[model samples]
Target: MCADYLLELASQLEFETVSACDTRDILEQLLESLAEHSAVTDIPVDEVVLANLHLALHQLDAIARGRGRPAINIPFHVIEGYLLHGFNVKEISELFGVTRQTIHRRMNDNGLRKSDVYSALTQEELDAVIGEIQQSHPHTGYRMMKSFLQARGLLVQTTRVRDSLRRIDPIGTEVRALANRTLRRRQYSVPAPNAMWHIDGNHKLIRWRFLVHGGIDGFSRLIVYLSAATNNRAATVLEAFIGAVNKYGLPSRVRSDKGGENMEVAQFMVESRGENRDSHITGRSVHNQRIERLWRDVYIQVLDQFHILFSNLEREGMLNPDDEGHLFALHWAFLPQLRRQLAFFMDAWNLHGLRTAGSQSPYQLWASSRHHEDPDQVEADYGIDWEGPYGFDDLGHQAGQVEVPQVQLQRHLTEEDMARLPDPNVHFMDAIDIYKATLQQLMQPRSEVDEGGSDA
Candidate 1:
């Protein structure tokens, strides 16, 4: 019976019914007796050993039946944060890698609850939405913030959003609410994203190095096109404007400040869209607030560092403000880098969540609001989504992929014209190649060669 019991104990280990931690002495006595009886007559097997075995098996059996399975525990704050970010329970479960039952239990245990109103209005979404507005247009007060959110399908109480804005940015809330209690402001409206576009040039950095020209859809606030060129010429602006038109299809109206640099754009809009239709409107820069507002963020977010760097270079005598060659080198070298920064800003701005145009990013607004008018939803309208928000069906519009169509319209140009056109979207390696070649030529010490390409 002792040997049979020992065999049974060994068999239990094979079937994984043993708990090594709980029954650490499972074989202690069996091994001691075996060692003591080595090379001698077998010691009589006894109930003491059998009793110990029975106790060990009982302990192992209890552990095997007990509930000691590994647990899945996620922090309450983490779930709360997800709820605050407008994630539904399903979404949170997927994020936490847990079941809905587990989530519900956790919520109940933590004394947290999400109401039906929370699911519908997404109050946490409002907090984020208002925060985005305060960030982009810091001067926007709480009342306007409420109107903005309500306009964009977020129907939150004014008091609620007001409190959120105050919480998110107390200083901005106090300062904006206190200042400009009354100011004359023109009413602005656009029926849709491509209904009208506002274009302008940012000259704040003109003294530093490059000039940035950009266009924004009035409704969606999408940065249609942003490019930097060395000169603020009419042709340059026209080229970018046309590029935008080709990419986004043509806008119903193009608004700009009455700068001569925009003459070509105005003419193009008038010619393409017709002057009788009010296709182009020129006014004071202040009246063209759509694109003007974009410049503030662009300068602060992207160009500020470059401005300081350039200013320091000039002040330190590393770059002479008067040297034509120095300016040329600056243009050739820094222009590409500036274009990249502008590209990043364009993407960041276009994809940034908006306060006024719903919580949707500019690109999202553009996608949803573009094709709401023309019933030819099954087709293209200069690549337009006419007849109501016929967004990209084949593939979603990526933020960084916003580019003007390179379709050379029905026009003829010489090689000189083509070469004179700025390629802001040039490949990085190609620019580096040209940069090195240009640097080599500029830095060449040609003491041995004469002007005639011969030794003097």
Candidate 2:
């Protein structure tokens, strides 16, 4: 086309006498041709295009480059979508199906870009948003926290929050860091919740010390068991677990840390802990190690901040700043006498604690099994059919009087399941030996008792 046009121009004018008017007209025609090419095809002629093209040609001159210069495959949908939406970096990136960095480069090439809009927000608005976010979720990233405003009809994007957040927050760098999931290489379980259970311990410093041991039902993601005590001992662990078992029934498997309390020999015997075991505990499971580490963030970051606040007050000779000082004093003194209190709190945690995720108390989850009552429905006599709440006595009476429907499940056991089931194994023998040792320890009575016959 170029050759044909040049030939016609040369014929129309003098062959060698080139005029400024002719050159300008030819250049304009070439520019129009290039513009038409950009519109028709996504050849990715952006800011970097000319310089990159020149570099490629120069490199090819030295050594024939294999493969054509890597032209970015800019999809047409991206460009059209950006134009329709009034292109912003994030929207543009979304249009191009690429990152903001890509959009930034594309805009630079096209010479159509704007400075970040987050900076345009007033200081008061920024403070209000940031304050609300911090109050709601201190641990949440700025990007994630922006949805609070967006929910209330503010045009806040995660990126905008992220940029503005950096200015006001000292931990702005950390906030941005958290936005990116760089450490997503951690293992993920199956998609379903009931596929795995995560258990862990956390130390909570309230009025008194709390060693929180908890279990979540894998399928329900419900708090099956929660024991908050002054101490996370084997006995407390057993009680907490027993409560969960009595409530939720035995899970397919129980997962926990290798802590002495969780991996207790006696507890394992009761559970028959192993893969494919007939015992309460199931086989092949992931443990609560992840949650345990998450607590480091909670304890060090959340609780530690409180601790610092209190410590600063003490250092300034202002003990009991507000009523919190009394609470802090109680906490300081109560840590020592916390063990006995833990036993009581363990039961309370199961029965009274509210769940942050579900907004239902642990007791509510357990009590959901109770029968429904229809007060509106009346008998022939117009007596309200108030099925008395199913308390322990009611359950006993119902069991004795009426036959509740029972499901009898039957399945042919696989070899793997059979092998996993507990029976007369070497461990069982060792358990017997341990029991004998315990008996000996108990049976060795006091000297006076040993000499005497039966007690008076």
> Each candidate's lDDT (Cα)?
0.61, 0.42
Which residue pairs show collisions in model 1?
371-385, 371-386, 371-387, 371-388, 371-389, 372-387, 372-388, 373-387, 373-388, 374-387
Error of 2 at 57 (Å): 73
Top candidate (TM-score): 1
Report residue 184 deviation for candidate 2 (angstroms).
6.1
TM-score of 2: 0.32
**TM-score of each predicted structure versus truth:** 0.47, 0.32
| Cα distance off (Å), candidate 1, residue 149 | 24
Candidate with maximal lDDT: 1
Tens digit per residue, CA lDDT, model 2, 23-99: 44564566567568767764434432333234333433333344534444454344433333223456455533468
Taking the candidates one at a time, how many backbone clashes does each contain? 10, 8
lDDT of 1 by residue, 278-307 (tens): 677765554566776677667765677667
After superposition, the stretches of candidate 1 with alpha carbons farther than 4 Å from their true spots are 1-187, 372-443, 447-456
* Model 2 local distance difference test score: 0.42
